[model samples]
Target: MASKVMMTPGEILREGELEKRSDSLLQLWKKKRGVLTDDRLRLFSGTSERAKELRFHSILKVDCVEHTRKYVYFTIVTTDYKEIDFRCTEESCWNAFITLALIEYQNRRAVEGFRRHRFQRVASEEQQEEPGEQRALSPW
Candidate 1:
């Protein structure tokens, strides 16, 4: 069984700063469906075959319970899954499916990028200020 962390929208909104490789998903959520942008408009499919093989465990099994106008819930039984949404299905199933897994992955990636940019900006400023060997490490 995979461990899951259920966070409310309020909790996600309260993050003040992003850590290295952290959650910048909130920024990415400027799209229509929050973080998971409509790939149809982006002219891309939501899921890729490699993403499925890499994300899903060998023993993983998914069954879609409902696909309504609002949201779709998929009951996924897996061995070890990091908190993510919308993974590709196995044989006999076509196209990507909606699951929490894909949302999590996109969120993580977006956050990580934001953090990396933040660090880069900080490091650049430090480099501009320091003129000697002290440039190697700036406590600030």
Candidate 2:
């Protein structure tokens, strides 16, 4: 588990309850608040214990986002198909925050993967070249 103090570097975009449908059987909604941060989304129950942590790297996509008169609703779908629902006051716009963070995370991952692949290809090519065949600086 990541320390909350260390999590400070991550911005907290929103803090509010995990919303439930009127017919849902789960009774714990009142105690759990969805916390949106730059690196992860967390569900915190009561205070000290973290119910769940969904890291940006593990997120496959945000399945849905909906709004009603009273609140904004969104669902985060993880790589493993775990769906987490959250809602906040209409003014918070938590859905946008989560979407932006996920986008940024995905972009960064893509760039890093590209860099690693390029480096490996260059290194392998250099190894395959004969010592005297290496390109030399132009004297002219």
Give stretches of model 2 more than 4 Å off.
Answer: 1-28, 49-51, 131-140
> Model 2 Cα displacement at 42 (Å)?
2.1
Expressed as tens digits, the lDDT of each residue in 36-129 for candidate 1 is 2222111112332222122322224455655555444344444574322332224312123323344454566679999999999999988977
lDDT of each: 0.37, 0.72
Off by over 4 Å in 1: 1-97, 132-140
What lDDT score is found at residue 14 in candidate 2? Answer: 72
User: In candidate 2, how many Å is residue 60 off?
Assistant: 0.7
Question: 124 in model 2: Cα distance from truth in Å?
Answer: 1.1
| Candidate 2 clash pair list | none
> TM-scores of all models?
0.30, 0.71
